[model samples]
Target: MQSRPMPQVAGVEHRYVVANGIRFHVAEAGAGEPLLLLHGFPQHWYAWRHLVPLLAAQHRLIMPDLRGFGWSDAPHRGYGTNARVDDLLALMDACGLDRVTLVAHEWAAWAGFMACLREPGRFRHHLALNIVHPWPDHRATIRHAWRMWYTALWEYPLVGGAVLRHWPGFTRYILRRGVTGVWQTPALEEFVESVRSRARAHAGQALHWQYVLRDIPRLATRRFRHQRLQVPTTLLFGEDDFAFAAQSLDVGGSHGVDVRVVPGGHYLPEERPDLVAATVSELFGTMESHREEIVG
Candidate 1:
C-alpha cells in the first residue's frame, strides 16, 4: 500500500491493525483510560483533529477510520451495522482493550449504541455527538422528516455512487450546509475526496440502504426489545444540526441517557471542539467523583 501523509495533529501516532478480518488504520495518542473516537460518513479519523489534541492530553485516544473510511480497507462487503460493531469489538480484542470510553458521531453512534448495549460492561461511558439512539419515535421522525432529506439520495446504489464520483461538490455541499459555524476549508475538500473512491462510495451507499432496508424494518418489529444500554451515556447535539432535530432526539427520562442541546451545528467535533472536550472532561470528572464517593 502506498503511504500517504496523514493529517497532522501533535503527539498523535498512526498504525494499522486487523480487526474482524478488516485492516483498520488507527490514529492514537496519550495515556490513561482508552477512548475510542469513531468518525461518520464522508470523514475519516481526521474529523476529530481539533478535539483529539485536547483529549489526548488525558486519555489514551483510539481514533480509527471506521472500516471503509480513511486509510482503512474498503472491502466489497461487511457494511452492516452489526458488522461494524463486531469490528470494534475485534479491534479492542486485538489491542487488549478490555474496556473503553466511547465517543462517536453520526452513523458511528448507531454502532456505538449497539456495542454499549451488547456489552455494557466494556464501555465506561458514551459521549455521542450529533446522533440519536436506536429507539426511534415514529411521530418525531415524521415531524422531522425534512431534516434527513439527504438520506434519500444516498439510499440508492448506482445513483449515489454516480453523484459522488461525477459531482465532486455534492459531498462538500452537504458538509458546508450541515454546519452552522465552519466554512469551506481544506479538510472539507479532503473528506469529499476520500469518498470519491468507488469502494468507499459504495460502502457509504450500502450504509444508507441498510438503514432503510434492514435497520428500519427491524426497528418497526421491535427487534431491539432485548437490548438495553447500561453504560452511562451523554448525547450532545448542535442546536443547528441540519440532519437531526434537537427537540426530536430527547432520549432523556430513559435509563442512562443524558441529552444536552449545545450551541452549534452537526459537525460539533470540528465546529466546537472546545465544547466537545469540556463536556467530555466534565463527564469524566463526574465519573471520578462518583468513584471517590464509592471508595469513601
Candidate 2:
C-alpha cells in the first residue's frame, strides 16, 4: 500500500507565485468561488489530492505547499501561526481572491483560526480537521499534554532536525501512527520524503518551537483567552486520535463551534479526504444559502 504510485490530478494546474517574500507552489482546479485548503506540518498541497477532484466540480480549489513544505521555498524563518496566515493572505492577494472558504488540517488549522479571528470578513466559513482551537481551556490542555509527547520531540532545535533529515523512518512512522487501514500510499511516501529534506526539517521543527516558546505564553494572557472567533467554524476531530483528547476539542463549544467526532486518526486529510470534501461542500452550501436568505 505504501509503495503504490500516486499520480497527480488530471485537470489541476501547478503554478508558482511570490507571496510573503517566498515562492509558493500551488495546485489549482475548476472555476468558481475559491476554496483554499491549507495542509498541516510535514505535508503540503498534495495532501489535498483526493479532495481536489471531488470539490473542483463546483468550486475553484487552491492548494498551496504553505511556505516550507512540498516544493515551496523553505526560508530560515516564518513558521509561526501569524507568519503562515500572512503567507496565505498574501497568496490570496497574489491570486486575486478577495475572500475564500478555508478548510485546514492540523497545524494549518491554527492559522485558519487566527486568520478568521484577525479578519473575520476575509473568510466565509472554516472547516478545521483534527485540531483544537487557538484559545482553549488551559486546565484541559495541561492534563492531556501527555498525548502530545511526539510534539516535544519536535520542539527541540538540534535533534528534531536531525531526526527528520537523517531518519526517513521517523516521518513514515509518525504519518502512519494511529491511522486506520493500510498506512502507506504514494502520497504518504511523498510526504515522508518531503520532511526528510533538511530545509523542511528545519522549518517543521521551527513550527513546533514557535508553538511551545511563543504561542503557549501568549495563551496565558487575557487578550488571547478573551479573543473570540468571528467566523462560522466546524472542528472535526478523529475519535481515535491520540494527540488530542475530546476535552480540548469541546473547549470552544460556548462560542458556537461545532465539534464532531469523525472516525479516523490524526491524519484526516490523507486518510479521509472524501469525508473532508463532502463536509466542506455541505458547509459551504449551507453558508451560501444563509447569505441568500439574508439578501432576499
Candidate 3:
C-alpha cells in the first residue's frame, strides 16, 4: 500500500532572529499557546513540517533550525549541550516568549531537556521523541555502534572539516543509513537537496556529528535528580527504533513518564506524523482539562 502524502498544513512564516550572536531561522504557524519543536541531527525544521499543522490548531507552533543546521549560523564553537540550551532560550527571548511547551527529537531532545533544567518554570511541559535520556556517562546502546563512528571523528578540529570537505559522499551515505525506514524517495530527496544547499554536502554532516558526540547522559542525570520537572511531560518512541530501547524505557519508568509507542523507525514524526499529532493532541487536551478542573 502506498503511504499517504504528507498533510498540507497551513503555510509557515519564516523569519530570522539573532540569538546569542548566531542567527536562527524559525518557521512559525498558528497563534495560541506557544509550542516549540526542536529537530535532530541530519535534519532541519523540515523534520517537523508534517507535524506543525496538526498541533497548530491549538498551539502557536515555533520550529527553529537549531544553531548549526539549515539557515541557522554554523559557528564552530558552542555546540555543546549547555550552549545549545542557551541558544534555545535566547531564541525564546528574541521572540518575546516567556513560557512554552517544548518538544524535541534526537539531539534537540537533549537540548530541550537541558533547557528545562536551567529554568523549569519557563517550560509548561515537554515532549521528547525518539531519544535516549541525556546522561553523559551512560554508554550508548544503539544496535549499530559503528554508525556513530563519525561522532568521535568530528570532535577533531582540522581533520574533521577536511574529511567532510574532501569527501561529500560520506555525508549522504551516513544520512541515508540514519534515515533507513523513515523516508520515501520524495522525502529523502527533499532532505538531501536541503542539506546540499547549506554548504558543501559535508558541512551539514560535520555539524550533526558535533551534536551526536555531546555529553548528554551526564547532564540529564544531574537535572533529573536535582531538578525534577513539575511540568506535565510525555515520551514518544518507536518500537523499532534501534537506538536506546532499554534506556528509553528506564527513563520513562523512573520518572513516571507518560509513554506512547508509534509505528515507525527512529524518525517517529516524519514517518508517522498523523499518529504523532494525534498523540500530542490527546496529551495536551488532557493537560488542559486537568488545569480547567483545578481552576474551576
Candidate 4:
C-alpha cells in the first residue's frame, strides 16, 4: 500500500500538562487502544506524522514532544532518564490511559526502555527503532559514539545553540545529511518544515545534548535484564543505518521479541512510511492473535 500523504489526518489536537514540574506538549489522533510514540532528539511528534494515521485507524495514538523539545517547556533541569519516564507516566495519567503500547526512536528509545524498567505493567508492548540497548559491549560503545556526535556538541552551553542558529539553512542541510537515498518530495519538505518550525527550529537541537550525556550504559545495565516482556515487543532497524554496528541489534531479541529490517537509513519512518505502517500493523495483529489463542 502506498503511504498516505503528509498531514492527511485532520483535526489533530494539542495539549499541555505539567509533568515532573515541567510542561509537555502532546499531539493526539484517533481513539482506541492507546499507542504512545516517543520521538528522539532533534525531532518531535512530527517524527511519527506518517505512522500515526495508519496506526490510529485501529489505535489511539499519542505523540508527545517531550520536555525540552518542540513547543514544550524546556527547563534547564530534570532532563534525566528518570524525569522523562515520570513525565510519560504523568502524561498518560493526564490522558486517562492506564496502559499503552510504547514506540520510540533514537534517544526516545532509551526513555521507553527506562519506562518499562520502572513500571513494566504500564506499557503493553515496546517498538524500538534504530537504537540498541546500551549494554557495556565494545561494539555497542563504538556504535553509540558513531551515531551520536551531535550529543557531545549540544552539551556545550552557548557554543552548540550558536552553531545551530548561526548557520542559516543549517537545519535543511542536517536533515538531508542524516538520511540516505532519495525521499519523496512532499515527505522531505514536510520533515524539513517540521524541523524548521518555530517551536522546534532551535530548541530541538539543544535537547540533543540532554539525551546524549545521559549515562545510557549505566541505566541499561541497571534496568534492562533477561526478564520476559509481559507484552509482545518488536525491534525495527534499517539495513543502511550507519548509526550502529550490526552487533547492536543482537542485544534485545533473545527473549522472543520480533526484529524487523526495513529499507533506508536511520529515518526509516519518514523515508519508508508504508513499510513502517505495514510492519507495525502486522506486529500488533500478531500480538492480538496470540492473546486470543491464549484466552481461547
Candidate 5:
C-alpha cells in the first residue's frame, strides 16, 4: 500500500500510473522506439538497471514494476500471471503505447510470452530472458523441478511472508545465487530491503502462490497449446540458471520462438547485459527499420 524511496538511476524517470485499479510504478528512459521491460520476482524496475544504460541511447525503455513489486502499490489480489498480463496491457494503453518491443526477465518473461500469444499486435518483437518457454515438456521440467525447490519457501501464504520478514538472509541468498557472482552489494541490498516491507512481502507471496496453484496446473494441462506465439520471439536461457535445466520443449509447439542457451546464471540482465543489450538492439532496432520502410 505504501511506497518506499526508489534509488535514483540517472535519466530514469519514475512515475505512478493508475491501471488495473492500482497505481503501478513505471520507470521510463531513452527515446526512439518503445521497449517494455518487465522484471521478475524480488525485483522491480531495478532489475533492468544494468540493461537501461546499455539500451537507453537507441531505444526508449518503459520499465514497470509488476503489480506488487518495487515502489508499485502491492494490493492483496492480482498476483497471478494472467492478472499481471492484464495489468501490463492496461498500463500500455494508459501510456498510449500501441505496440512495443518486449524485453522481459524471469516470471515477467513468462507473462510476456502469454501477452504476445494472446495479442500479437501488441508486441513488435520479444526478447525473453532466463525463463522457460510456454510449451515446456512436462517430463523434462519435472526432471528439473527440484531446482525450483527454493520457490516453496517463498510460495506459501504465511510462510513466505515470514521468510521475507524474519529471515532476510534467505532472500539475499536467492538473489545472489541466481547470478553467477556478478551481483554486487547495493543491488542485492536494494531488492532484499524492498521485499522486507510487509506489503511487498505479501505481494511476493501471492505472486508465487498463484504460480504454484494456478500456472503450474495450466502447464501440466498444456493450456498454452491452444495458443501460439505469433510475435517474433527470441528466448535467452542462461546455461547455468539455477531455476531450469536444458529444456526439452515440444518441437510441434515451438513455432515462432527461438531459444538460445547463453553463458551465465539466471540473472542475464546483470550477468550478461552486453549480450542482452546487443540482442535487444538486433531484434528491436531492425524491426523498427523494417516497419519504417513499409510505412515510408
Candidate 6:
C-alpha cells in the first residue's frame, strides 16, 4: 500500500526492508561509507531531499520513513524511543551495515541519542539537528518549557489526529514558520500538501502522542544522565527555533558532544541543507573542513 506521495530525487532508489519487525520504506542514493538520515516529526525521508544531492558524492545515504511516517508500515505499536532505536539497529543489520554516520533531525534526533548511548559502536558519529540532547539542564528546560506549547495540540491522541486530518493548516503553518530560512519553492509545497493525506498524517499524530507519553518523562527524570555518550556527536540547533531554548539544550560535560547554533528557525534541513551537508561530511571524516560557519 502506498503510504503517501513521495518526491523523486535523481539517483535515489526506493526500496523496502523489514527492520525491528516493521516494513520500512527507505530512499537511497550515493555510495560510500554508509550514512543514515532520519527525519523528524511531520516529515518523512523527503526532508533530506535537499541534502541528498549535496552529500551524494561523499557518502551512501539511507533515509528511512520512521515506522509510520512515510511509506513505512504504520503499525499501531513501536512509536516509543526504544522501539525506534531498535528499528535503527535492525535496519542496519538488514542492510549489512555494522556502523554508519547518522544525521537525525527533530524527533528522530532524540532517538538517535538513545541509539548512540545504547550501542556506542553502532554509529561512528551523529549530527543531531534541531533537537535537544538527553543531557539538558532541567532548570532551563522548565523555564523554557513554554516554547513547546505547540506540542500540546499534537501530544494528545484524538486532538492531534483531528488537527492533522482536518485542520492541516496547523502542520502547514508549522512547516512554513519553522524554517530558519525560506524553503525552496516546490519543496515547501510538497511538504504542505503531504500533511493533508490521512495515512501520512496518522503517523504524525501517533508519534507525537508517543513522545509525550514516553520521551517527555524520560527527559524530565534524567533518564540518560549516566549513559555518557561514547559516540562523537554534535547537537545543532537553530537560533530562532521555537521548540527548544538554546540554554535548555545544554549537554553534559563531554568533549565528544558539542552544540552549534546556526542562523534559522527549527527546520534546518530545509533551510540550511548546505550546513547540514557540511556537518555530515565533517562527522563522516570524508571531507576536509572548508565551509565557514558561525557557532552561535
What's the CA RMSD of model 1 in angstroms?
1.6
Q: Write the per-residue lDDT of candidate 3 for residues 53-137, one digit (tens) a residue.
A: 6777788989988876667777656777778888988999998989988888987887777777678888878888887554322
Which is better, 2 or 3, measured by TM-score? 2
Task: Name the weakest run of 10 consecutive residues (lDDT summed) in model 6.
Answer: 287-296
TM-score, model 2 to reference: 0.93
**Counting only residues 3 or more apart in sequence or on different chains, how many pairs clash (N, Cα, C under 3 Å) in candidate 5?**
0
Task: Estimate TM-scores for all models.
Answer: 0.95, 0.93, 0.81, 0.81, 0.95, 0.91
Query: lDDT of all the models against the reference?
Result: 0.83, 0.82, 0.68, 0.67, 0.86, 0.81
Worst 10 residues of 4 by lDDT: 1-10
What digit string (tens of lDDT, one per residue) describes model 4 on residues 71-100?
577655656677778888888887788988
User: Which pairs in model 3 have colliding backbones?
Assistant: 134-216, 134-217, 135-216, 135-217, 135-218, 136-217, 136-218
lDDT of 1 by residue, 153-270 (tens): 7768898777776777778889897788765488888888888778888888888887788777876686875566789888888988889887666655364678889999888888
Clashes of each: 0, 1, 7, 0, 0, 2
**Model 1 TM-score (2 dp):** 0.95
What's model 2's lDDT at 227? Answer: 69
RMSD of each: 1.6, 3.1, 5.5, 5.0, 1.7, 4.6
Q: Pick by lDDT: which candidate is best?
A: 5
Q: Candidates 1 and 4: which is better by lDDT? A: 1
Candidate 5: regions farther than 4 A off: 1-3, 249-253, 292-296
lDDT of 2 by residue, 106-178 (tens): 8899888889888888888899988877666778888988898887667699888888888878778878885
Model 5 worst lDDT run, 10 consecutive residues: 246-255
Ranking under TM-score, best-scoring first?
Answer: 5, 1, 2, 6, 4, 3
- How well does model 4 score by local distance difference test? 0.67
Model 4 residue 64 distance off true place after TM-score fit, in angstroms: 1.6
- The order by descending lDDT is 5, 1, 2, 6, 3, 4
Q: After best superposition, candidate 3 residue 265: deviation in angstroms?
A: 1.1
